[model samples]
Target: MSKIKTKFTERIGIDMPILGFSHSTDVTAALTKAGGMGVYGIAHDPPDKVQARIDAVRGQIGSRPFGIDIMMPKGMPESETLESVQAKLPQANLEFVEGIAKKYKVPEATTKTFYNTVLRSPSYFEGQLQVLLSSDVDLVAFGVGLTPDAVGRLKAVGKIVGALIGSPHHFDAYRDIGLDFIVAQGSEAGAHTGTIGTMVLVPEIVQMAGDLPVLAAGGIGHGSQIAAALAMGAQGVWLGTSWLATSEHAQGDHAIGDRLRGKLFAAGSGDTRITRGSSGKPQRQIRSAWTEEWASPDAPEPLKMPYQHALVGDLMTAIEEHEVDPLLHSPAGQGVTWSLELRSVAQVFQALSDQTIAGLDLVNSISKSP
Candidate 1:
């Protein structure tokens, strides 16, 4: 058995130092049953759908502790209706998407219902927060920073609030703002990451955070990396890309699971690039023709925030619906090269535990020999 233990596992009541982030209820339940915490990604779902997903995970986990991650940007603009945002998308970008669809032989399909779904907008932020407060979720994690008032409200309702940060400066800024824990996400991470690598970022944030527990995220797909993170003073590892190829991830005709699995299988460490074209935030994504098109010189600049996301909402829907393999892309870290095999969540957790123990043993042996 692995000897890894930290305040994070103790506080969260989990056996392992692995925290899996996924949008699938199956994956979350499997991770919980495997003795690690599973944080469901609900930032992309509306409030009503978010509650339903939470309930689904609860139905399977049965009293096990799990968390939910949401995006609550600090000092967000005033709430704007989804329609209003969609209407503001520039025609040039619209024409570009149309051109891509035509070039790819994408069928004509109305994505009106998809466009109307308001997942992560300023307008739905409060409603999403209320959903978490009223649910049985053991923890609530903010992908972006949250206001002190919002953090206090979550804590008042007996929820442990955590935040993900990319730099020590952001950590220093928000360290004393009532965050229960901080996830130091490095540049190699999937979505919305910073410029520092995990080796440098984790320890820096851990030092800056003082007693607050820091979870090392980004480029952590293997057990050796988990042991290394613990050695770097991280309480645990926050993993998302590693779970993307798991058996329990969304896999169907309409889902991007199969394509993502294929891409990870064929990808190398250098195959991903960080581009702001996806959501107007610099995020690491598997290189594909879709990303290539966005990076081309003739492509219009990606709009900011909700507008960029809104602009491509229907295009993404069409890609998913039509299974455009060339255009299919998902947020994946540099460690994606390690995720070549499709394993069950339980198997993945077991491998992490075994590898962590082996890695620690290797270090111990080397130290004794010296």
Candidate 2:
């Protein structure tokens, strides 16, 4: 891929003007190797494993620019254990979650849930932040909770800082926080997003951002979408959900990665639902029996932040652990419509680049014709 230079790609030093976000380290490294930026989602991992993952990515990419994303929801305890949080849960919430397990006949999990290890506590965020601050990673982005001191700390260590914002207000709050780049994630995005559409949000953010680089996120699947984003003044595209179905993501979980991969391949643009089921935030995920149950009139109002995650923690583990087909899901965007089949990350990356090149050529021809 020839360099598709943009403020983001040039400043961040990548070939393709696309940023890939995924929980899989392989996906992260694959994007970097394939001429794009990859940001490993590390909010779910324990503090100790954070450095190992960064080192692993560094090994694969060998000093290529890649990043890590942390999601820290506010108002969580300084530190709280899963056991302690579980004990304090309301009876109705517990029973509701229990009923879902029973309804689906989900098997008991043999291993501990990842969420069990991740508390939405301030201490937990601090631990992860400490890992990023001291590590050799090139970029740091906040997906949810934007810490006031985190940007300065990361910058101090000579790291580029970025954040995903969902609205104009969010941009207002973060504009002065010293972000090197901004991702205008519309509601069409997969998880933890607000109600704005990408078309409207991108231009607004771009104009408001002044000279700061803006990456248009959400609802971006095809090269035409990438071209459209550039035309809207976005310096680049920030993509996540599309990578969920990539061959790299299908690295096959020893537990149940295959089933999840199949589910993702089978899903479409219309198959997602915006619910508070994932983390008590309006996140778009593949529609499943679990979401349906939660959407029921009988279902209790979902709990907040860590509590909601805690309530579904084991159940989510068991679903993946047992291959609960109807209940399996991932946070994905409407762009998933384009990822109907599994393709290698490089293959997909090339296709997007080719299409973008063609799209830009078409635009150039049109402009010259008139």
Candidate 3:
């Protein structure tokens, strides 16, 4: 066998240690074809859609290894069926949302779409996990917190279980559960993120996880950042914002990518806020009118998980669709500007490897000179 590259490359059966984060199968397939791991996000897509996406990636990459990321929080909506959960939703939940919507002045349309997603099972996490297991996925990464029991089940199947964690506490929990890996996400990341910034969180998790491979996440966009993550003891880097600007991203809007690429630093600073008003739980998204409203001193406190997401999920959709006022758009990390141009996923992967290798050499040269 050829010599293994990074610690992550050896473990994931890839030539490069980069893991592309995107919901697009095209991106996943391209990354895998380029000799890196592609982690497709199937959190919101329905099972059929997920299956098709998986099939597409499989066709493009053949048996090349890839992974899937699912959003399954421990103890979220316990009903066996999505219909059951939707029907059984407490009126108090709706009332609670109405109160918050009024308090935050959230547009009526945005509230509807946000609620629909949380209540309906577009892709029930458990059901989709079953589908993923049926396929030839190299690993499974949970996009949210999970219980020890869930981790045990995943491990029993001889699959890697990667938990997305934001703090040292989360790192400790995943480590205790013997998770295969942990994505150490800092606040500078897009979409869902924790209060801890990447610079601080990456090292903390590397130290806390001990031997478990830590995949530095969040604001990692360029080779320098990836090198920094490796120097800090991360085995690899998990990327999203960088992928969003790629030609394969399916975001279908050059302007959106342009806006993201242009405002990378401006968008990633302390200006980012943690709010459950978006998808429940504390996710670091761009500060928007919606987040500002909920955070205002006079505004009412947001409800708990699922409830808050249920209430506002629909509204978010409406905002995206232009039916309601734009509140906030999903984004993460300070490394977005590095993704200024729309390159192929394969090109991006190659760039990361080249840059990381160059960075490592620089580090070694400096050490020798001293």
Query: Which regions of candidate 3 are displaced past 4 Å?
Result: 1-4, 79-123, 251-271, 323-328, 367-370
Q: Per-residue lDDT tens digits of candidate 2, residues 290-351?
A: 77888999999999888888888888878877788799887888888887787888988999
Q: In candidate 2, where is summed lDDT lowest over 10 consecutive residues?
A: 249-258
Ranking of candidates on lDDT, top first: 2, 1, 3
For model 1, the stretches where C-alpha displacement exceeds 4 angstroms are 1-3, 75-79, 110-116, 251-255, 368-370
lDDT tens digits, residue span 215-322, model 3: 898878778788889889988888987776667764431124444334443454455566766665676666666667667676556666665555556556555555
Report the lDDT of model 2 for residue 85. 88
Candidate number with greatest lDDT = 2
- TM-score, cand. 1: 0.94
Residue 87 lDDT (model 3): 55
| C-alpha-based local distance difference test score of model 3 | 0.69
lDDT of each: 0.82, 0.85, 0.69
Clashing pairs in 1: none
Better of 1 and 2 by lDDT: 2
